[model samples]
Target: MAEQRRRLDPAARRLEIIETAERLLARDGETVRVEDVVAAAGAAKGTFYHYFPTWDDLLDALRTRTFEHFDARYQLPTEVDGPIDWMRVLDELAAAFVGFTLGQERLHDVLFHSDFARRRPLPADQNATIRLAAVIRAGQEAGVFAGLDPEPTARLLFAVLHETADAVAEGEDCERSLAALQVVLRRALAARPEEGSAQ
Candidate 1:
């Protein structure tokens, strides 16, 4: 029964450990020990060790978890009645961007300023960018959006969103920063017609 019980808790324990560790690591971006997570999660050190034997394991888990969360939020829809519009996409990205920055206050500043971001410019967010780029490409193919360079456009949008997240993570007015990001991104990506606009 002990083995079965371990199995039962493995899934839950693993996530709990990761989530707890992410929350803590975000704080000031300092080192997080196994004992800290164990105490916070009210689990034995063995439980944390079972999930992540090393500190690097914990960091990798946190990065993966954050990316997973970001990806899940990336392709979500807005309440707009029409098909996916540039405004809607920008709004969604802004919301997700703000959510990631604001929700993980402890890690945001450190993550942005640390070598992690600079070191990995094309982090796991590239997966999300590829996913969103495909959607934008579909929009263009379907004639919803004007034809344009999808790759550069998507990267530009991501850069804007990242900058907004940085501002928020730096303790600026996060909500306002998100709103500003939405405006900036929308203006940058708003589709123009293939046909010349009449005066």
Candidate 2:
């Protein structure tokens, strides 16, 4: 007798299917087929259609999921072990972003650099810029960042991160580029000392 596959609820089943497709996409690029995804996920064709009515719908979900994973890596710190080192937080965020971009090269390109991506951009609020601005605002409140407009500052920093990561992805030396980027970011955002502090 063959072992039975455990049944999953609607939400779990949907997420499982999406994640399975994500793995396949990462492995096979745009050449990946719906049948390949379903077969690999141990899901029926009907089940896939239940979650994603069309192939494009699945791609959209995949893009959203990829961004979610990227955002989760740099989410605002809810709990601190000790004094918050905002600079270190920024550094870690930059490093994590770079690591993800490099580690998931094919997936990143397929989801973000392809023609399909140009046609469908993420909504404003759900973008990485918004998340970075939130971090900047938190840092400003903590007195670690200067009194700069968080949104614009985040936009600029995001551009820097994006371009630098692209450079690394396109053959620039990762260590050198990343180190320079970190220095540039820290210097640009560091809070200045009080003007009259010297006695």
Candidate 3:
């Protein structure tokens, strides 16, 4: 008699499909096909279509998962007893961004730099840049960062980090790029001398 295969619940099964695709993506990049994913996942073609109606749908889901995975690394505490070390927080956030990009270089490129991804923008509120902007606002309140609008500064800083990580992924010197990032971030966000004096 054939052994019975245990069935996974909806959420678990969906996650399994996504996880399988991630592995295939890491191994094969954007060239990975839905057939490859389904085969590796041990699921039927109908199952893959049931979860993701189209290939683009799957890519969209992957982008969301990747963004959330990166965001989870730098979530700030909602409550604090004393003054926050905004600069330290920023450093850690920068590290997380660069580290994730480099560690998942292939996946990152497929999900972010791909033409398909560029056509489908992630929602604003759920994006990683918004979270970084919140940190910038806090830093401004604490007189650690410049008093400029947090949104655009956060956007610029995020771009810098992205480019830096991409350069490193393309075989540039990691240490030097990181050091340059630190300098750029500090200089760009640091409180002006006048602002410090006023405080």
Candidate 4:
């Protein structure tokens, strides 16, 4: 007789399904099906549906989760009392972003370069653009960045970063690309003498 499997808690089951699905996605790229995830997760089809209504929904959740992980890893320091070093902060953020992209190429492609990504609008609160916008706003207040509006500037920076990340993911030299990108970002956002130099 076969041994019986222990039942998983709802939260544990959901997480198992997401993790299983991610593994399958990494192994099979975007061609992975919901049935494949169900089998890999050792769950019934209905169980998978209970947690994620559709395949696209699961993909979106995975993308959001990935971004959350990245955010937690590179979150800005909020406890500084003195003047902020905006240039250093930006450099740190850029390095972290590029490093994550290079290290998690498959996940990065799924989150930012997939067909589902093209179809759905990303949540603003969970997006890197919003986080970068906050940094830009802080720089403006600290007289370390140009007086341009933060939202558009952040969006443009995000766009540039996304493109550069994609290129790196597709086999470009990460260090060279990141260096060029940093130069572009600094040039685009560098404050004038009247605004206060980042130095």
Which candidate leads the pack in TM-score?
3
lDDT of each: 0.67, 0.82, 0.83, 0.81
Provide the lDDT at 161 for model 3. 94
**lDDT by residue for model 1 over 1-199, one digit each (tens)?**
4455356557887887777777778774666667787777777787777777766566666766777777766765543665656556657766776676678776755445555556545355545567657656766765655566788777777777777777766778977887787677665655676345674
Model 4 / residue 180 / CA error / Å: 1.9
Could you give candidate 3's per-residue lDDT for residues 1-199 as a string of tens digits? 1122226787887898999998888878988998899888788889889989988899888888887776576677554577778888888788788988787747777877788767887678667678789999988888789988888888889999999998888899988988889889999999887864645
lDDT of 4 at 195: 61
For model 2, residues 76-153, the per-residue Cα lDDT tens digits are 576456668889999999888888877776777777777677778877766878888988888889889988889899
- Model 3 CA deviation exceeding 4 Å by range: 1-6, 195-199
Q: Which stretches of model 2 miss by more than 4 angstroms?
A: 1-13, 67-75, 79-82, 115-120, 123-125, 194-199
Off by over 4 Å in 4: 1-5, 79-81, 194-199
What's the true lDDT of residue 167 in model 3?
Answer: 87
Ranking by TM-score: 3, 4, 2, 1
Mark the regions of model 1 whose C-alpha exceeds 4 Å error after superposition.
1-8, 42-46, 71-74, 77-82, 109-126, 174-176, 194-199
C-alpha positional error of residue 180 in candidate 3 after TM-score superposition, expressed in Å: 1.7
True lDDT of residue 31, candidate 4: 74
lDDT of 4 by residue, 135-185 (tens): 998887888889888988999998888788778877899889988988988
